[model samples]
Each structure stands twice: as structure tokens, then as C-alpha cells.
Target: MALAKLGEGANTGCMTQTDDSLRDHFLVASPYLEDAGFHGAVVYLCEHSAEGAMGIVVNQPLEITVGEVLDQLDIRRERPDQPVYAGGPVQTERGFVLHRTGGDWHGTIPVSDRISLTVSRDVLEAIGRGDGPRQYLMALGYSGWGEGQLEEELASNSWLVTPADDDLLFRTPDESRYAGVLRAMGIDLNQLTNTVGHA
Candidate 1:
């Protein structure tokens, strides 16, 4: 499965705890997480288990557009312009698509009842023909945590966990998503601090 391929090169030696999976959740970067790559980032978890966690950063859109990517890959395009997100710090050369689940694709991993992750070009080809998933977030690369890395970070309060919302994930504006999640949780931005607090 495409999701299993995510751990192919990882050597974190993390356990595989399917029952404790955090799949389909959102990882909102806490203010205390000062890493330039993740500061104020909003990640949608695609797969999470004891082996590790993998997700896509949905709030950071690159200047490059879907049209540009299609042109670069020589895929015909009939759709309107769409921004491509910078998914994470790993595998930046590869592309990943998070879209509303429906059509069958060659390389697809279901993230939830409503979302699936596709790493093959066939979906892009379909999009080029105006027949892809109705809503999608196209990105390059993806955020990943090996072994217990994510747990340690969570222990240190680096991320605010929240249930994944389709409206926030697919329909919310990129710039507003970070605060939108907070708002949905009734959190005031000014109240956020390094101190641990449940979302």
C-alpha cells in the first residue's frame, strides 16, 4: 500500500500500534515550536502508528501552481489555477495529493472516510482532464516523524491535536486555517503559550 511505503527508508525502529493510531487528526503547531519549518504550521495526519507518524502541512502554499506542476510534468491541464502546498521537509521532489475519496487510483491510501492520499500520476492526469477528485490539496513532500519522535514532541507540547474537519481541511482559506482550527476549539490566540493546555 502507498501508506506502508512511507516507512520504507525510515529507521526509527518505532513500534506498530495500529490500535493507537492518530490517523485523520490534525497537528497544529504550538507557538512554542519555533522550528522555521513548522512554526504556525497546520498538518493533516494521514497515517500514525507506533512505527511513526506522517502528515501533510496544509497551510503553507508555494508560489508554484498546479498548472505549473502539470506543465513541468507535461500533463495536460483543463482545471483552474491551484496552489501547491509545501507538505513538509522530506521528499520535496515527490508529489502527494490529499483529495476527497471516490475514484480509484493506482497509488492511493485511504486516510479517512472522506479523504485519501494519492502518490501516483494517474490522479494528476485525471485532474488535467477535469475529472479528478472534487476537492484536493496537491503538495510536494510530507511531514514525518520516526519512532517516538512525535510522542516526545507531543509530550513537550509542540502540537495541539484536534479532530480533522472537512470544512477546515478542504474549504477553509490557507491563511485562515491555522486560526480557524483554534477558533473552532474556542481558543483565543492571545491565550496560547508554551504552557501545556488541551485543545
Candidate 2:
């Protein structure tokens, strides 16, 4: 698959939430984050509100394949080689599919006009039958934050927020999404330092 390069946009330095909703945004883990699971992760925020936040880490491809997952469920696999991702730290046994909007699946949440997140088995059934969305990533688990948790992290510079792009979410290779999002936001990954600026 050709990795589409994202177009450059304003270099808005590290962003902290104001009043805008972060749903459908990209949560790029700061380089200094000490958590091993999230290092270099690019999370696609599916739900973000005053109560809490939920997202799936899109760039951490596990050694497993979608076929492997379906096989465990006794579902037939037509696309066996597609890589699966380690979505986050919660519910590792559960599966989540981040795909382009086109199917009528149960438990589907529209993340954006073009993207949706599905947790129901029917989506997987359709995929096993070779009738799923053309662009999709199957992941196990998802990142989550409690009320005011994400905002605290944002205030502490633990993450950088940017508008999520479909190509970056669906077209870019899993290994390249972190840098891809940084590039799109006019950020040079090498130039990012761990030092937090204080006013």
C-alpha cells in the first residue's frame, strides 16, 4: 500500500483543550511519555467529552493478523495478511474496528463524517465473508481516560492534539502514523524535546 504523505498545516505548538471537542481528533503521545505501551502511539479519539475520553491507538500493530483473530472466533478469513493493532491498555480480549463509513453494523459509532468505530461481531462476520469496509483496522483494546484526566495530561504536555485526517488514519502504514501526524502539523519529530515550557 502506498503511504500517502499528509499535507503540511499550521505549526500550532503543543495544544491544550479550550472549548472545542476532541472527538475525531488524533492524540499523539508525547515522546517523553514513560509508559512503554504508548510510546510512539498515535491514537484516534472516538469519544471525548467532559465525562471522559476513549480512543484506539492506531499505530501499534501487534504480531497477530485479522485472520488470526477471526480464526479464534471460528469466523472464516478472506483477508489473512492484514495486520491487527494493539489498540490500547483496556479490554485486550475485545475487538474494535476503525473503518471508513459505509456499512450498517451494530454498535457502530460515527466518529466523523467519513469514519466509524464498530465493536459488534456482525462487522467481523461481514469482513470474514469479504464484505467489510475497504479501509479498516482491526484492533484489540482501546485507550481510555477518566473525567478531567485527558485535560490534565494535555495541561502537562503529555500529548499533542491535532485534527485527525482520514488518510493518516486509514492509508498511512501503522509504523508511520506518529511521524505522519507530526509532519502534517508541521512538526519535526527530531526537534521535539522532553522539556516542558513554563510561562
Candidate 3:
């Protein structure tokens, strides 16, 4: 949602990726994306097949009420409580689950057969009642790539491919996520830049 932006509109400088291989990779926005939701962002690639690519911004946390989202689905929580995450720049009203599978959950998107995304309000209700999945995250909206868009950006050095880690998803705090990923890469925060074409 707009909360992820903390800005007034879409970034005029966001580079589109144009390579096939980079589709399933992650985009760690350079220090140059420092004015909005993308500032120091770390995106996780959810799809990278021939058709298209998709992901979610992992670092930005929103101030929205998860209960509000549940209510939209007509599911009520006996005791509402759970943090909401900024997924990306698509349908902010829709719900997406980035979590481990099982335990009475429904309406999931299979990121991998082993790992899935459950987006229905039932999941949220269960979570609010302390009966949610073993581990999960609620994301509103998502980042999408069409055809050659991701490839173009990857060729320009706009993203980095890394294995998605559960610890990074569930344990890291919002403020430090992007920096943490860079640290894992043995790169210092001072070394990245927004100039993708030259990188």
C-alpha cells in the first residue's frame, strides 16, 4: 500500500529488469532508492519461470491493521493481533501469505510445493487466535515482472540472486533487513549504488 511508499507516487527512476535468469533472483535496492518504499529494500523472488517473475519487498513494514484486512474477508478474529508487511506495488487490498505450510490453513499460493503462501482471512483469524501456522507473514500486494522486464534490469545489475532463508523472513527486524542481507553477502552498506547499468 501507500504506507510502503511513504511517498506520493511511483518512483520515476525504478529500473526494469530485462534478463531471463535474473527473474528468480532478489532485488536489493541500491542506496540510491533512498526516498521511498524501495529505499534500502530487499525483494524476494517468488516466480521466475518463462511466463513472468514476481516478488515481495521484504524490508518495509506497514502500520495497517491486520484486523481490518480480516474483516474484509468476513472472517473475524476472537483476539486480533499480527504484524502486516508491505508486499509490493500491486493490489494493496489483496492478502498474501509468505509462510510454512499446514495446520488448518487454506487459499495458499504454492511458491514451491514445500513452501506456500496462504492468503485467506481464515488464516489471519487462526493467527489472531494464536492458532495460525507454525511460521508465517502477511503481505499486502506484490512485485511483478512482465516478460523481458526483469531480464533487462538484471542485465543492468539491478538485483542479486540469493537463496531465500526462513530466518531472514521471520527473524530479521524491518529496519535492518536490507543491511542484513548485504552483510550476509560480505558486502558493506557503503559499497552499493543506484547506478545499475554501470554496476
Candidate 4:
């Protein structure tokens, strides 16, 4: 996985139009996907193009708190302790903010009409002051794929992609996100198998 600074805005050069892009979608790891980093991961695709795709693993929470991060950044902690999520395997030290679109912030990229991705410090500052977007997820790092890489994985059935919903992204519990996505797709987890078959 290649990691880039989210604060630099998205790298759109490599992106090309496909029949349909997965932006503003949810990628649920298939049962056959054995990569420890992605197993059972439910990623929210913020950007996708021929250049590649970038997303955050919404279900994996690191053993850190929002208050701790604010303290480290010297931002006054005014909110209660919130769990910080592990976005993905790339750039573990970097941060990405996934939130509802409305608040103005530096380096904010609208993923869709309803959601946005921001990496600037100003949003974090606002969050610390309780004036940030009403709904936000603070993630450290993100998942990235090279051009055509994500499509290849999709062809191999490594992921089950679905349109994202606000409930799944912001309201669902992290631990149940993977299954919740599957349920939203009308798939039962108990009946799923590792075998991939073609007609």
C-alpha cells in the first residue's frame, strides 16, 4: 500500500473513469481475504479513480483516545474521551478526518454531497473546541491502492462493495460494522463461504 499525506488533498492524477467509481462506498472484506490488515475490515472509500482508491477502515479502533491526541497536539481537550480509529496499514502516524459535510476547514475534500474528508489541523482544533462537524470520525492513517489494484482485488472477490449510508458510517458500532454492511446488502454471514465460484 502506498501512503500519501491526506492534508495535501487527494492525488487525482492517476484516477480515470470506470463504468462506476466506488467513491462514497463501503468495502467489506470477504471471508477469503486473509490479510491481517484487511480481514473483517469495513472501509469507507473516500476517493477512487484510475489513479487508485483511498479509504479508511472504520471498524478498527486503536488503543488511543481523542483527548490523548489533542493533548499531544497541544490542542485543549474540551470534549469527552472518544476512541481514535486505526484507518488502515498505511502511514500509521498520519491522521484523517471523516465527517459530515457542512463545516468549513482547510484541505477538506467532499467525498460526496453528504460527506467529506479533511486532514488539516484547523478541523482538529475546532473538534477540540466542540465546534466541529456534528458527526466525525478521527482516524490515524488510511488504506490506499495503486491504479487498477483495487479493481483487481474486486475481480478476485476479495471485497464486497456497497453504497455507503450515513447510518453505517457514523452510527453503527465499530465492532459490528463488517457484519452490518453485509446485512445491509441482504447477505447472511453464516452462509458465506471462502470458495469463489464462477457461473
Candidate 5:
């Protein structure tokens, strides 16, 4: 669903819906999103269907350190070294928790149930206590797809889609997610053209 919004460029316009009809796909950036907020973004397809897809830009790390945000909330990182991600352009001041599930810590968005998104403040407090999920990434915003938006993008190849892995979501280094997702598709970053437009 994240790639469905590829209407912003050319590669998306040339794609056909049949190109990808599977579940839990990843959106691989084309190496040209120069915007500091989205440069080399990697998104996770949470939902993809005829209605359209919705995703979260998981790998775009923001200059805002987790420790800094903690200060904003009057809390401090249990581990000062934790990284903070851009999430997306929405709710830059809000927080979203992308974390491992099936643990004793309940109450989440139940993205896949196995993988959940928590927008609650409690997650933050839990993190401060060092009693949160096994692994997690904190993001400032999120990405969304409207009905029919993703389908059109798939036809244009704006987003190179591939399977999603929980390990990758929780463990992949933020700096490498964009290219890393492409690697999952066995693609070379140099092979993608920066030319974006509707074919």
C-alpha cells in the first residue's frame, strides 16, 4: 500500500497491478528521494488490497535523537543510545512504537498482531523503565495510502515491492533500510532510474 502512492513519479505509472498481489511487502526507495526527511526511505506495507495500502516509513532516521524527544516528554531514554526515526511527514511531534509482539507487554495497534504499532504515551514510559518490547523503533510520523492510490503506483513500478520480515523491521540498521529492502528483491541500486513521472 505504501508504494501505491508512487504517483509522484514515472516508474509508478508503468506498473500493472498484477505485478504484486502478495501480503506484507516492503517499499524500496529509488535512491533519489533527496529530501532529508525521506531520502532513501523504506516503508512497510501494513495493508494492501483493492481499497489501497497503508504503510509506515520505517527506516528514515531523523536527526532528532531519542534522548532529545525524551527530554521533550520530560523522560529520558533508558538507553541513551537508542535511535529515533522520521516515521513520515504526519504528526512530526507525535510518537509511534514499532516493536516486537507476543510478549507480556500488551496494548498495541495490532498491525499484524505479531507486529504492532503503539501510539500511546504508556509505551514511552515503559521504554523509560526498560520494560518494553524485546526490540523497537520510535518514529515521529507515518505514511498513508488512499483507496486506489497504491494499485496505480504498482502499475508504474514507483515502488519495488518485496516480502516483509520481522527481523528486518526490528534489527535492520536505519541507515541501510532503503537499499536493504531492494536487496531483498535481488535488485541493484545502480539499476534504478531516477526519472520519476507517470508513464
Candidate 6:
């Protein structure tokens, strides 16, 4: 399985909430975040901890299609029209599936009761056969941060954090996801400034 190469480092672990953890949240890239890959991105954070953080860029679709991936793995595509996502900047070759159903698949990690992340081929096989979770997004690679790295970025006002919503994750159009999230938070993009002042 190509996903097995991700190894134990990719495990999502149990869904444990901490005062500092951003798990099950959305990280919206601030306009000040000049990184081209993350600019205007809406990231679904799957894990966050004192150790680090991991997430998928939910709104960036690659040119590749789900059908192409199924063909590569020899899995018959029951639904072939979905686009694959560029999950993050790290491990561009690895694949991760953010799904909305619980199943005992290999390398499956629970993000929440309604969401999970799976890195094994069995889930893909099931999707090909129309037997997988009801809704899913397949992404290649994921965004990650080392200990204190994300905190430093947060302190720098590089991102805007919001509670994750299923509608935003699965229904919003890719082109507008970043703006949509901001709107949902009652924020006007034009009103935001690059400079954040401390009280």
C-alpha cells in the first residue's frame, strides 16, 4: 500500500481535546501568510497537540481525479468524478482520506465522532466498490508543524482559527472556501489588517 509508507508518524491518535489543541478546527490562511501554497487556503485541522499539528488543505484541488487514482491502484471506480485535493505542503507523495463515517479500516484515525482520517488502501477499495463512507475527500500530502512552530505562526497572526463545520468542509465551493469561512465567522476580509496589535 502506498499509504503504508506514511508509517506511525501519520497516526491521528484518539480525539483528545486540550485547551491549546486546535483539533477539529479550521485554520484559515491570513492574507499576511505569504506562502503561496497556503495563501487563500482553508485547512481542516485533523490533529493538534503540544507535540505538533497536522491538517489537509481542504480547498485546493489538484489536476488529478479520483478516477485516476483508482485506476492506478486497480480499484474499480464506482464514482469517478471527484477531484483529489492537495492536502498540504509536506509529503506531497503520500495520500490521506478525510472521511465522515467510522469503519475499522487499516490505519484509520478518528478525528471526531463524525469524521476520521484513513491512510490505508482498503478504504479506497471500498470507495471504488461503493461501500465506503458516505462522504469523503481524498488528499495527497498534509500540512504539519513541529512543536511550538504552529504556535509561533499563530502568534504572528498568520492564520485565523474557527470551529470546523461539515458544510464548509464538504459543500462550499473550492474557489470561495477561504472567503466563505471568513464570512461564516462574521468577518469581512476587507476589514482585516496584516498588523495585529497586542493589548
Top lDDT model = 1
Ten contiguous residues minimizing lDDT sum, candidate 6: 1-10
Clash counts per candidate, in order, are: 0, 0, 11, 4, 14, 0
lDDT at residue 60 of model 1 (Cα atoms): 97
lDDT of 5 at 131: 76
- What's the candidate order when arranged by decreasing lDDT? 1, 4, 6, 2, 3, 5
lDDT digits (tens) for residues 54-135 of candidate 3: 7878777788666666665566566555667888888775667677756655455556544565555556667667687767
Which ranges of candidate 1 are over 4 A from the true structure? 1-17, 193-199
Lowest summed lDDT across 10 adjacent residues in model 1 is found at 4-13
Query: Which has the better TM-score: candidate 2, or candidate 6?
Result: 6
159, model 4: CA deviation in Å? 0.2
lDDT of each: 0.83, 0.79, 0.64, 0.82, 0.62, 0.82
For residues 1-199, what per-residue lDDT tens digits would candidate 6 score against the true structure? 1133322334434534578788989999987676877878899998888878888999999999988988887888877668999998888888888889587787888787888889878888888888887788989989988888999999878899999998888877788888889999999877764343421
Q: Can you write out model 2's per-residue Cα lDDT over 1-199, one digit (the tens) per residue?
A: 0111111111212223336779889999886566777888899998777777888999989999988778887888787568999888887766788899989875676777999877777788888889888889888888888889999989877799999999999889877889999999998887775343422
RMSD in Å for all candidates: 4.5, 9.5, 7.7, 3.1, 8.6, 3.5
Better of 1 and 4 by lDDT: 1
Give residue 39's lDDT in candidate 6 (0 to 100): 76
Off by over 4 Å in 5: 1-23, 31-39, 103-107, 193-199
lDDT of 2: 0.79
Residues 1-199 of candidate 4: C-alpha lDDT, one tens digit per residue: 2233543444323344466899999999987675867888999998788788989999999999877888888888688377889999888888888899988786677788999888877788888898988898989988988888999999878899999999988998888888888999999887665343422
Better of 4 and 6 by TM-score: 4
Q: Is candidate 1 or candidate 6 better by TM-score?
A: 1
Q: How far is 6's C-alpha from truth in model 1 (Å)?
A: 14
User: What's the CA error at residue 142 for candidate 6, in Å?
Assistant: 0.6
Inter-residue clash pairs, candidate 2: none
**lDDT, residue 168, candidate 3:** 73
